[model samples]
Target: MSPASPTATSAIADGVTDDALKGLRRWNLGLTVLHAAQAVAILVLGNGFAIAVTSTFPEGPPGADAPAPSSLFEVSISVAIAVFLFLAAADHLVTATVGRGLYESDLRGGINRFRWAEYSISATIMIVLIGFYFGITDITAVVAVIGANVAMILFGWLQERVNPPGRTSTTMLPFWFGTVAGLAPWVAIVINLAGSDGAPGFVIGIFASLGLFFSTFAVNQWLQYRQVGPWKSYAFGEKTYLVLSLVAKSALAWQIFGGSLAG
Candidate 1:
């Protein structure tokens, strides 16, 4: 539903007035309703399937047949869209319900742990599911990729904290590191694709498409820090984020449905 970089750096003079903040908060609340509706529709209309898994741990003699892998937890891949969509809705719901003072303070500081936290889980899950279709089925590889995605998001959180507005315009180590971390999973996914004979064209399209969408979140933060034209307005960047979330999530949901989940 979202990507790296919680909010714009304070250095950008968006003149985020209280009225503007209130308006944006309402937008996020409205997003909650829309995302919730999509989640429900996905669950009601789509047939679900389990993502295969594997792991090794202390075990007794194998049964006459191959041992079933221990379940870290089971979730349906067919309805995966609903899962992340629900999570995104919950993130916005909390933002809307929370005290305005805290939300404004966090935004001003260039930190929104709520956004990163949800992205860490929601986006990671979506990517992992995508990787599965790429033939990245080894549990260790999957877990490692998941860790990389989560790390990328944590660095995005750090980007906000360490580089609060008015700080020296020196190097932004966290943002750069986060961007690299974001690349790791796609690299793994590509490797999976390479090993296979080939994959569906639409499947490859999913990879390229989502890769571009997620990349833009980092771009958004870069613009905020650079204080370039148009982006010089933090309000502009904020509005862009809402629009981005809507488009990116919808693109992903429909892409998955058309390419893999739909019969």
Candidate 2:
């Protein structure tokens, strides 16, 4: 089905919210399918780089030469990271576009500045991650990761600086969520810096981080969808923002950590 248009749900959201959701859903089916296809391709191509006959990996430096973990385990891990990178790209594009497109569509809430900041920082992080993945894994990765963290710290400050009246209740969740999500990339970078052998520490840290993120999200979503009191009572904008942020962070953590392991 075609995605819903801007006005389709206008009655529900203040004009601004409706406009944002509409723009987000704009290329819904096509964008989602394309994203999925891209993810699959990256995984397949990435796997091909492996010297080991048992699995796939993208061609690259001796990074791939690192001794294999259990073949199944390594392949599975590689596939997970490839998927993470692709989705991070997709989410960054979609969220930023939605935030902007809403302004273009009739809901200009003094939010463009915030959206721009969010988009810019996110894109920068992705770029750094991309660069690091391609062979610049030493000090350069450290620098990029540090830069990304600084941007996010600034983002948290900017959020409060620009907070608008009436929306505080709703915006708090998303604001914090975004803040935390932005920090997730650094967690992987730090783990990488410590060392790499796909040691149990790295593997456990990656999975544990993911589990914590998703568990929070699933609980939030369940509460919201079930119309539970806690969900309804927590404040509207807050829950939505947090729910979205948690999911994004979990995915981001997965991708970066996966890439580190795969490489």
Candidate 3:
């Protein structure tokens, strides 16, 4: 990663201490193993998530036979979940293997360039899977959903760019802006679900659990920036993220495993 701008020192200088470094070191290894193990379990146990796009047409002329549905594309939910898991694991692994200097610099900047870079791809895929579960198949619509999520993550990166740790609280517009951008897909998903009859129990679980987890992630960022309570320590937010990543990825993977792969 490139050097963090000089604009990131207040939080690091005040929030990162000897105890915090020790804590970060422990979480760095723990989270790596946590994500890696979950990804491997999904790979070893689950076959794959099967998705076929089939359209049932409305009533047509009685004299003609309706056209048959065809599959547009097939994707493996296992792969999608695993991608998210591995990207998170890779983020932690970098600190262990590469050294924490870059990681610390990222904290100094109030953004982990590594995390956002991976989330841009991994979280986008996770949201795309959510799109599929919501019964969205139009190529254009799917692309739009992907764009929305990526834009949301880009806003996260922009949080650091526009207002680093050293920046005054008044310049924190990017953080709120990112939160708004993050809600775009959830709004779209809720809209879709509202029109449908219902969803499967496991599908609902996937949506609820992941949504809550993602929202919690944004909260972590918010607290860290606001210097609220424990979040006054940047390391506090880092640990929370580690736990959240583990829980979110594990919850999603296992839900899919139990739902579709048990057979």
Query: For each candidate, what is the lDDT?
Result: 0.76, 0.43, 0.76
Please, what are the lDDT tens digits per residue for candidate 3 over residues 93-196? 89766857887766665666777787788788888777788887556567777887888888777766655555544355766777777788888888888888
After superposition, the stretches of candidate 2 with alpha carbons farther than 4 Å from their true spots are 1-23, 48-81, 89-125, 133-135, 139-263
List model 2 lDDT by residue over 1-263, tens digit each.
11123232322323345544454445333444544565565555444332111223445676566443223321243454445445544654554465445433422322333334543554454434433443234443446555765565455444433433233233345346555755666466445545655545544454455445534533553354344664432234333543454355445544544554433
Predicted model with the maximum TM-score: 3
TM-score for every candidate vs. truth? 0.84, 0.31, 0.85
The Cα error of candidate 3 at residue 160, in Å, is 2.5
Q: For model 1, what is the alpha-carbon lDDT of residue 176?
A: 93
| Candidate 1 Cα misplacement greater than 4 A, ranges | 1-13, 56-74
Task: Put the candidates in TM-score order, highest first.
Answer: 3, 1, 2
